[model samples]
Target: MGQQEWMTKDFYAILGVDKSADAQAIKKAYRKLARTYHPDHNAQNPQAEERFKEIGEAYAVLSDAEKRRQYDAIRAMAGGGARFSAGPGGPGGSGSFDDVFASMFGGATGRGGAGFGNGSFRFTSPGGSGGFEDVMSGLFGAGSRGGFGGFGQQPQRGGDLTSSTRLSFRQAIEGATLKLRVEGREMTVRVPAGVRDGQQLRLRGKGRQVPGGQPGDLLLTVEVAPHPVYSRSGEADLIADIPISIGEAVAGGSVEVPLLDGSSARIKIPAGTSSGMKLRLKGKGVRSSGKRRAGDLYARVRIVVPRKPSRDVTDAARRIDEAADFDPREGLTTQAGW
Candidate 1:
């Protein structure tokens, strides 16, 4: 949808739910409205189709957790609803809504009246006509003005802080807590289990101080270190290599395998299991918060040959070769055009 719709639509009202509704509640409302007003379901009613599209657009923004938060913040800044400027020849000057607002609230009377900075607005005083109080009261209304005193009295949320955290391969898979040092303060943060590398963690009310407002959050970007023996695929699966002796490969047995959680588990190897064989251990891999089911761990077998053999072993090998008379390269010459 266009920017105007974003500023005008009350998504919570359209979905028939409160602003405090959780993600599931929002989803349920959207689905119900969407199905009832679907284009196919109301082919003869153009209004139903339009309403369906509007509901879909609203749901698209409000259903997502992150996007919903941002939308709510913007809406709050607009005082529950946004203000639009009349078109050309309207009461205000000929310009965009933002431009008109800037002209009216953009001077020292407002803050320094300079203009908008970053994501905030600043106001300045007029030439030499009136005092700070007079100009501020005139611009921002009597209850709250825009001067040093007024600004100091206003409640403004603290600025958000950003940081980076690094975790070991196993920690990334199993999750970990980190002690972070931000702005000369030490804080402990819990990194959710199964967090992937490069994911961001947000800690609420953990930022710079604000005059009369609550503190903002701290945003941490996670970096996962590589493992010596294991590799990750997607968010859950793990791959590793397992070495087996020649005797074990032929005889089959149970072996102790290291897990990502720093523990060990017994893995069974079937008799006559060959080199390059793969074994899967269920529910032993990474866990994901988004999905219900856990992933599996895959181990690839590598058979190791002995560098030296005893006389009896050599003799037994020779006898076995003679008895089998096997030719592993029998078709290589023909295939290679030798």
Candidate 2:
């Protein structure tokens, strides 16, 4: 907003707050009003959207400490039956805003080339040095020369454009290239391998471009969809539960395990392997980059019990139990020390 706007608009009244309101109180009031008027919540009401924007502008000015101070000072000075103008009948006749400023701060103003000293105030503009134009430009914005870009600094880059996209679990893991439309133009983005859900990727120089300045970046957030059969651990580790029968586990045979690459691996089950035992397949998980180590695939064994058995099988099990005569829970009491 222009610096002159502060002399007219009462930001405190716009925000429905007091001049002495604390920062947190002002913020809370702004949030409450903003939510009530937000277009997302009140889409059918067009006035609500406009009111939301007004509230945002009011907050933006009042939230900054320096801007708030300047606004208050300007309001106190040029408010109530008084204004600074150039023509006759101007405050005290023929005085300008610069004259009001010169009186406020310790300075001298006259037709004798207007020398400024005894106070720290200087306005450096082409063809005009100590005038209202330079002062306003320093407070508000530089017209074309980009004066201070807000108090005499050079121009700054524009803001980043934020967007989000959804990716399948496999696409997130294996890495894929994507094409998206932004600002009426298509841009290519690369999703790296082993990227976790809710990860953010920044596309440099792909956002809003400032006039006579560098462009901003594009912050692309990713949401990975879930997979039913495969799960992840740490950076790139793949975890899967391999279900096996009690017979297969006891006999120690080779079993087929599915991989993320649309292929299956034959895993040899060691003899005496029990349920919940984990076996690692090296370099079968996610890819590594830079100083990161490659991930491994962890397969956990889960023994499945038969829901029902035939009478012949029951008879055979009884004969085998009698022949073995081994107690699996023999050391339970000793281990528990009960």
Candidate 3:
């Protein structure tokens, strides 16, 4: 931002903080304003967007010890005893830091050169190298990028910030509003439904803000916790292992399976169904979240045998097995060309 801007804009007032506010106080104030004016939270208010930007800019400058020092120094140098102005002369223009710097370096050396004289600020380039703005950029961190590089534009957009969160498997599939701590401050972020684990959610205008540029985004990484009874498959299907009694598997029957949505779905087990057989319930897995389509639920059947059999039951089982003459794996080797 221009010196005029830093000189005029009351950053402390904008942030509703005292000039002597401590680092913690400044941070607390900024976070409160950031949450209040966050674009997503106040989308309907154009003024809030602008206010949010202002709050960020103030925070960015004040939060950094070095930048804060420079800012205070600049303002101090511009106050009483001396006045700042363009086109040298006196009070209104001369006798200021600019005039002192010019005098220090014999005559107005034009832009683009190397270090000059004894130990007087070891800069790579002899700074008087460009427009007046370039000179300003060198003294104060503004107008140019890479700071002392050269004078051209205002500060670039604020840097992007990163944060992470843990979500329940169900929460990952269903949209949720999350409160997260970012850069040691608390802010609210939205997690869209159907968000896969390891995916990132970008919260716009929710990052650091440059003095005179666009605010950056907050990149949120999501992690879904594992579920004991259910798991997510590559096809977005929800899976579960269902154990059924031998009788239920041998004769077609209905089995109630748990769903990710905390509900139960009844699936039919075909007659003579074997262990490891899979049953599917279309559109019964994870419900649609955002643009994701509904997913299916797959249940793998596991047949449980009776731990102990009565003499009569054992005899009846042997008779039934003898009558059925079926061996599911009998032709496995022949099919493999054994």
Predicted structure 1, TM vs. truth:
0.50
TM-score of each: 0.50, 0.53, 0.52
Off by over 4 Å in 3: 1-155, 306-317, 335-337
- By lDDT, the better pick of 2 and 3 is 2
lDDT of 2 by residue, 1-338 (tens): 34556667888999999999988788777766765775657879988866765676677667667657767766766654443333221223334444545654445332222123322233444444434544554445333332321244455454455455668988998888999765456888888787887555767887767688767677665667888777889887888899998667767888999988889898899876789898999988888445266688988888886779889778866885697688879999999998
Candidate 1 Cα outliers beyond 4 Å, as residue runs:
1-155, 290-292, 307-338
Candidate 1 displacement at residue 153 in angstroms: 10
**Cα lDDT over the full model 2:** 0.67
After superposition, the stretches of candidate 2 with alpha carbons farther than 4 Å from their true spots are 1-145, 149-156, 182-185, 291-293, 306-338
Per-residue CA lDDT of model 3 for 1-338, tens digit only, reads: 45446666778898898999998898777766766776668768989867766776677677767767766755665563443333312222444554445543555422223233321221222443244344455555333443232333445556556555678988887778988766566888778777776555668888867776877777665667787767788646777889998678777799899776668888888999988898988887766555356788889888887789889878877886788888768989999999
Query: Which model scores highest in lDDT?
Result: 2
Instruction: Give the candidate order by descending lDDT.
Output: 2, 3, 1
| lDDT measured at residue 190 in model 1 versus the true structure, 0 to 100 | 76
Comparison by TM-score, 1 against 3, better one: 3
Residue pairs clashing in model 3 are 111-128, 111-129, 112-129
The per-candidate count of clashes, in order, stands at: 15, 2, 3
Task: Report how far residue 285 has shifted in candidate 3, in Å.
Answer: 2.5
